[model samples]
Target: MCGKGQLVTDLESGEIACNKCGLVSSDRLQENRAEWRTFDSESNDRSRVGSPTSLAYHDMGLATVIGKANKDSSGRQLDPSMNSRIQRLRTWDFRTKAHSSTHRNLLHAFNELGRLKDKLSLSDAIMEKTAYVYRKAQEKRLVRGRSTSSILAAAIYAACREMQASRTLRDVANATNVKRKAISRSYRILVLELDIKVPLVDPMKCIAKIAN
Candidate 1:
């Protein structure tokens, strides 16, 4: 090891290396900075401007919607004609976003997911996993001719199993107001089509859940 204090941090490789001996002192360092890229110092800094992209959202939280305000950039009220045109634009924007069947499906499914997340007090990780499972099932056309709520509930249960969360099918069914049998059937479909390896539930967790 080089005794020299000269260390070079490679941001791209996430490594801290000894400049003199070319030995890496650390690896897999996490970047805690804001997700903003600026090429020049003279450029305006736009760091931490928005929420991080997430799968829990139908549009992955990246799509923007026109504001309902009828005011211009300078806060001046728009003319009646202009206001009408803006309102029409807003309606079109909203419709275009969910125009496709897949988009409409996701919009509804994610809305249900949000409600269940609060009702079940599910963690972000579990919700994200649920979203991923639901997306995969949708892609495989397993959602066609099936109840969306049932498939979503099944996805939630599958996510809980994969994530080792102490949630039962009964819990999901109660939170989602879906029939347990439907959820079970949809879960089996997910396991078969997606080939997901669900982990066995811990008896201790089940006891703990019951005790609570």
Candidate 2:
């Protein structure tokens, strides 16, 4: 006969037995020990926040600038949109504060930003990229059919519209030393080759962004 909390078993002829409580057979228990090895000691430390030597950083100011550019001008927080473009802008911004360079380069970027802003189509990120792109084009001698200044202006205008900056072609042209006609022509060429998009700006979005 089995008592409380005990097991009863029948033998060949019909005998009964009682077993100890809370007893587990060794064969019925599971082995659950696990071993882990550390790889951190063997791996190289590869943590970096920004490319301090990159030209993009020399143009945009820092990652924060690019991040701010992606935000609504009203400074309200929202879900981050256009992650790819934002990253590109962040890279450009880094060039501004991280790189070692001359005042001329800094001045050049600032003037470029002013022109970009005047266009009502260019975003801060697009402006920075356009300047960086122009510098690269100059180094590669790939410029064609227009003066470098005009080409740069056109690129800036194109970048602004592509990245939804809120600038116009005429405005960017007026801000540059290059003639408006040349800027126009270069703009057409860039549009044809780069397939840039022109986006609509809604004041409500800006307001909603600001009001919050």
Candidate 3:
């Protein structure tokens, strides 16, 4: 970032960026569309909007959810038959969205990535990048017979490599409960299959990380 670092939006790619530095703040930002309205009521609830969509969810937070309650949306209690029907709807809705094998694999992998992010104190950007790498790997059929956690750890390691993050393989291996060899194998698979160009690690940052 430089100068005033004014925010800019890329219309084509939908990326939020800094105009001065050309740094993308977020690539998967949620779209916000507002239809103009005149609000004059005292109890006008404008701030109670729902959560923003997220890429981290298996469904990307786009799938509809039926809340577990005996009441309807207008706060009316349902009859016994209606209650069972709503419960079945909820169960089927969840199953319909979650039944994909790739989705389940990615869901588990992302959860593993989340735990590693917490343990290693990695930023959201790094986790997002790792997720991209993992998804790319899955797309290439590189995760067919491999451990999901191992592939996710390798994805995080590859992201750190690309970003020149000072984390070591031993560090990630310890934090992710995966073996160094497994991470290496998965990393190789990612490189060979995805044709990803993982940049060299910065020696100075590595030295500083070791000294710390």
The candidate that achieves the highest lDDT relative to the unseen native structure: 1
Q: Candidate 2: minimum summed lDDT over ten consecutive residues — where? A: 24-33
Residue range 83-180, candidate 3, lDDT tens digits: 98989998898788769899988788777777666688676556667878888888888889888888888988888887667778999999988899
Q: Candidate order by TM-score, highest to lowest?
A: 1, 3, 2
Segments in model 1 whose C-alpha atoms lie over 4 Å from true places: 1-34, 37-46
Model 3 TM: 0.75
Question: Which residue runs does candidate 2 get wrong by more than 4 Å?
Answer: 1-124, 132-142, 200-212
Q: What tens-digit string does per-residue lDDT give for candidate 1 at 1-212?
A: 57975887643234678889999888744324437766568978655545677788999888898998899999999999999999999999989888999999999999999988778877676777899999999999999999999999999999889877787888999998999999999999999999999878778877977898
Better of 2 and 3 by lDDT: 3
Best by TM-score: 1
Per-model lDDT: 0.86, 0.53, 0.77
* TM-score of model 1 vs. true structure: 0.78
Q: How accurate is candidate 2 locally (lDDT)?
A: 0.53
For candidate 3, list the clashing residue pairs, or say none.
none
